[model samples]
Each structure stands twice: as C-alpha cells, then as structure tokens.
Target: MSERKVRVIVAKPGLDGHDRGAKVVARALRDAGMEVIYTGLRQTPEQIVQTAIQEDADAIGISILSGAHEYYFGRIIELLKERKASDILVFGGGVIPEDDVPKLKAMGAGAIFGPGTPTSVCIDWLNSAVREKWARETA
Candidate 1:
C-alpha cells in the first residue's frame, strides 16, 4: 500500500473570534507537507472531533484564546475517548496560563504551544509524534 500524508485538523473552538494563529499554524503545517483541514473559527468541540474522525486525521490542533482552554481541551479529549478515537492525538495552543499546561497535558494533550512559540517547534513535534504513533501501531 502507498503511504499517505499525515492528515491534521486545525480548529478554533468556542466563541473565540481570533483565528490568525490558527490560520498561521494550518498554513505552516500544510507547507510542511501535512494534509491540513481547518475547521475554521467558533467550532464546537464535537464538531471538531467529528471532523477529525471523518477526515481520518492523525491529530487535532486546537487554537483557543478565550481562556476556556480547560473546558474545550478536556471536553474534546473526553469525547475522543468516549468515541474510541483517542488515537487522534489532541494538542493545542493559545493564551493558556503556564500552570494549566501540565493539567492539559495530563488530560492527554500531546503538546501545548503557548504564545510566541515558533511554528517550527510545533511542526517538528507533530512530525515526530505522528511518526512514533504510527510506529507503535504498526508494531
């Protein structure tokens, strides 16, 4: 079988109208040869999860600047588990406080890219993480 490109769903969840960061990340991911499907602004956690599963995405990258990271991240992770889609890794970025990073990570977020983090950092981490996950599954 032919190898497929890594598919990622980049989303902006909740009523947060800020999307410049999300758009930037999506573009960066796409430029790095990943197939990116942007769920656009104000997407609910359910919608984002549904889109990811439907698109067979390897990961979901959420961007939230509305200070509702805890709810959105936790809910998405929970929903993925509930639907047996935990393999679709969840990661996020935004104005989250440093203290909450560990909590979100504990909730199964692969990584959290805070403000001013270089896109290359995210790109590299995602590539490595996806590669490792694929290896584990194949093994």
Candidate 2:
C-alpha cells in the first residue's frame, strides 16, 4: 500500500468569532506537510468530531479562546470516545489556562498550546505524535 499524508481537522468551536489563530495554525500545519481540513467557525463539538471521522483525519486541532476549554474539549473527547474514534490524536490551543492543561490532557487531549506558542513547536509535536501512532498501527 502507498503511504498517505497525515490528515488533520482544524476546528473552531462555540460562539467565539476569533479565527485568526485557527487560520494561522491551519496554514502552519498545511505547510508542515499535513492535510488540513478547517471546519470554519462556530462548530459544535459533535460537528467537529463528525468531520474528523468523515475526513479520516489522523489528528484534530481545536482552537478556542472563549474560556470554555473544559466544556468544549471535554465534549469533543467524549464524542470521539462514543464514536470509537479515540485513536485519532486530539489537541487544543488558544488561550487555554495553564491550570487546565492537566485536566484536558486527562480527558484525552494530546496537548494544549497556549498563546504565543511557536508554530514549529506544535508542528514538530504533531509530526512526531502522528508518526509514532502510524508506526504502531502499521507494525
């Protein structure tokens, strides 16, 4: 079988209208050689997870700045679990509180990126994480 590029879904959830960060991250991820599907603005958790599954995404990156990280990320994780899509690596960024990082991680978020995060840092982490998962699955 031929090798496939890592597919990622970048989504913006809730009533937050700020998408500049999401767009930036999407572009960065795309430039890093991953297939990115941006779910646009104001997506529900269910919609985001559904899109990820439909797109057969290997990873999901959510950008949220509405201070509802817990609810949004938690709901997304729960939905992914319910759908048995937990194998898909999930991450969150944008104004996340440092204190909540452990909580979100415990709920299945692979990582949380806060403001001023270097794009390369996230890109490298994603590449490594996806590569490792793919290797494990294909092994």
**Cα lDDT listed for each candidate:** 0.94, 0.93
**Could you tell me the lDDT of residue 62 within candidate 1?**
93
Report the C-alpha lDDT of model 2 over 1-139, residue by residue, as the tens digit. 9668989999999999999999999999889888999899999998999999999999999999999999998999999999998999999799987999999999989999999999999999999999998998899
Give the clash count for each candidate.
0, 0
Off by over 4 Å in 1: none
Clashing pairs in 1: none
**Best TM-score goes to which candidate?**
1
Q: What is the TM-score of each candidate against the true structure?
A: 0.97, 0.96
Minimum summed lDDT over a 10-residue window in model 2 is located at 1-10
Model 1 scores worst on lDDT over the 10 consecutive residues at 1-10
